[model samples]
Target: MLTQLSLPKLQIPFLCHGQFMVRVLVVSQAVAVVLAFAPGVYGDVWARLGFISVFVHWISIITTLCLCAARHKINQLKPISIISVVLCIFLTLTLIVSAVAFSLFSTLFNSINHEMSDFLAKNLMVAFIVALVAVQFLIVHAEKSEQLNAQTHAELNALQARIQPHFLFNTLNTVAELTHIDADAAEKSLLALSALFRAALDVGKLVPLQTELELAKQYLSLEQWRLGRRMNVNWQIPDALPAIQIPALTIQPLLENAIRYGIENSAEVGKLNIFSIESRNALTIVITNPYYQSIKSSGGNGIALDNIRQRLMLQYGSSASLTFGNSEGLYRVKLVIPKS
Candidate 1:
């Protein structure tokens, strides 16, 4: 049996955004200027402009407040329902404001006279047309935004998926090597591997920094078990890790790269160092390992680094960064995560 797929529901723009309100105010003022100069028998154009501006500003402010108030409910409505609801609010407010303006205009500006019915009809018509266009534009913009978000989510998941298999295969190979050498150690490695996988597989867009660090520790323990004295890791983490969220599986892959490229390819004991520098707005993690020039690294391809970079961009936009290079005979990777 085939089932129909459900498309994403339409989302309303946040009407309370400062930029949006500013645009509304500017457009309303422009409209007022145009209306005031519409070839009328006006003695004073400035007076007409002032009157129209006041009227339009009143309508704009009231409409904005009404929409902002009903935004939560309006967002839950279907496309047609949302359009209908917004139009009703706009037309209703415009009519009321138009009536008030007409009464005041007749009393104050005796030179210009507009019948109540004509004024109300004209205001309602304009409100309906403007509201319709605005609603359609907002809906289209939201739909495109939703589609872009969906595409990004799919790409993020694909990148995340790519990382797991590489991690699993590498960890399993290490466990296999350990089993032949020592059974009890292999059992402990399996336990650690289980904990690592649970964190990796069940992770969402972000996890606590502490959790990611723990996962990295588990992975490094498995590697230490396999490599023994060949690999020595020095941790310089703070006693109190910052309460921040980081992308999952971030640190482990960097450590894996260090082990694969820096440690395993070397004959002498390799040194790996992990440390953190904390500031008010950002946390920086630095990983450094020996870079051997003569000995060619067997697995030097940068799949993990590239994957981590893409994931960081998706999560943090441009605020967070991952950078690495060889500095003074040592390869260094630095990851910076913003507190925001």
Candidate 2:
């Protein structure tokens, strides 16, 4: 669904402020209309050319700029309906002003009686086509700008929401217990907790793949300390990790899910596996954990997974993906990122 945001005339967003693109649209449209008026039946050849050159560029550029300004409202209409109505309205306004100016200026400067009806007859259809092209360009550009803004806003909110309260409380409890027995270890745990929270708050930006993997490792280490031998992690990362870029804290939530579903609920020690495979075109990271069958399953939709997918779409378009599957008694997730 489209947003109900409204915009007023003459207020263009920064994305629509490409003056070079606007001028190019104006000049090309102006030349096309001028050529259509070459076989002049009006008074003076040079005067007709000069008047059209001025009028065509003026009308086309203003109409396009104004369309961009009003895009939020205009985009609500259906595609064909918008194109038809926009062309009709702009063409009508353009012809009315051009016809009146033609008569007034010809009479004043050329001292000849030229009819407004003749001017309208000469330029109406050609001006309509030019207006159509200009309006379409602005409409497409404005719509894309709006979409990108909406996605960015959602991604920011997701970043702020991803701070897990349960993780914080559990880690603090572990810190309190460790403080009494092993003061130095407790101090290290407190520092780790603080670092993780700081990283959580500053996500939604890009970082190298190794940095993201390190964050996941930090999180797992803390969880293992709290859970003792019940939580086990096996990392199969390469000595030379890929230098690819990904969103910061991208893998942390997945690790949290692993602990929640696989380790926390189990009576026996549960194992979590982290491994990756790389190819020339893409890299795939696989996470697997033992899922005991005795516990009754609770159904809940995954907000973290949805958030990651949306962020991936915004950053990599269709080049990245997240998928889930199960084999034997183990659950698995695979994340694929393009090398490009």
Candidate 3:
């Protein structure tokens, strides 16, 4: 009962703005058609449409301005709600004023000096109705947009929290063993592990290639210490490619997951390769690890990979892609980052 009562209400400002603008455009178009048929009907229908476009453009501009101003850091909902009501009132007044002016200009021209107050009043009423409908549409749109944004933010936070458990749980177990066997090696391992966590925590949705490389190296160092003679690592990062940016932790987590699953699960020795190349205005990172389906029955947990792919889509739209495949018993993951 309390959860239902206390649920935060969400509103989407973009959708509201969109619906309002679209209605305004439709109304303006109708008005232009009428005006073109009236006295002194300028060029062609296309010219009248272009002229009406300007007013529609202004409506969008003003609505955006209103939204930008709507944002506030107020804690209490009442004050913000009051402000939103006030903004709606202001928009209504603006519409009324615009309607009055248009009606007066369209009907009471000096060339005719005709008494058309009744016609002008009717047009004003129509305009007010149009504006009110637009505002209602705007409110509904805003609510949806706000809900979507909240969901996206929550998902991102969940993904970040999920990563810590998978890597840290395994690392801590390795550290526990290292501490008892070799004190000096364990100390170095702890430091490298700290760097790894720091890197994960510091990263964002997108990061520079140089930063990723540094973090990748730190991760490899920590894992090497943990695995000792059991793990072999190779990295091929060209100096020219260092400046290029990639999705944050895009390459490292996959590498870590590969090592953790590939070598830790296998009794036989395992090797990992990290390679990057810039070709055809695209950056590709390939991570390869030995795979034995008999020993490791399942595929990846998929959360981290899915997170990376989603982040790529959110940040780079359709320009970037990630692919996974197996060839001759070697598991490979590839990331393609487009320059264009």
Which candidate number would show the highest lDDT if scored against the true structure?
1
What does the lDDT read for residue 249 in candidate 2?
Answer: 68
- Assess candidate 3 and give its TM-score to the true structure: 0.53
TM-score-wise, the better of 1 and 2 is: 2
Worst 10 residues of 3 by lDDT: 7-16
How many residue pairs in model 1 have overlapping backbones?
0
RMSD of each: 7.6, 12.6, 9.2
TM-score rank order: 2, 1, 3
Total clashing pairs for each candidate: 0, 0, 9
Stretch of 10 with least lDDT, candidate 2: 6-15
Give model 3's clash tally: 9
TM-score of each: 0.56, 0.56, 0.53
> What digit string (tens of lDDT, one per residue) describes model 1 on residues 163-229?
5676678778888988899888889889998988787675434789988898888888988887889
Q: Any runs in candidate 2 off by more than 4 Å, and if so which?
A: 1-163, 292-301
Among the numbered candidates, top TM-score falls to 2
Query: Cα deviation in Å at residue 260, candidate 1?
Result: 1.8
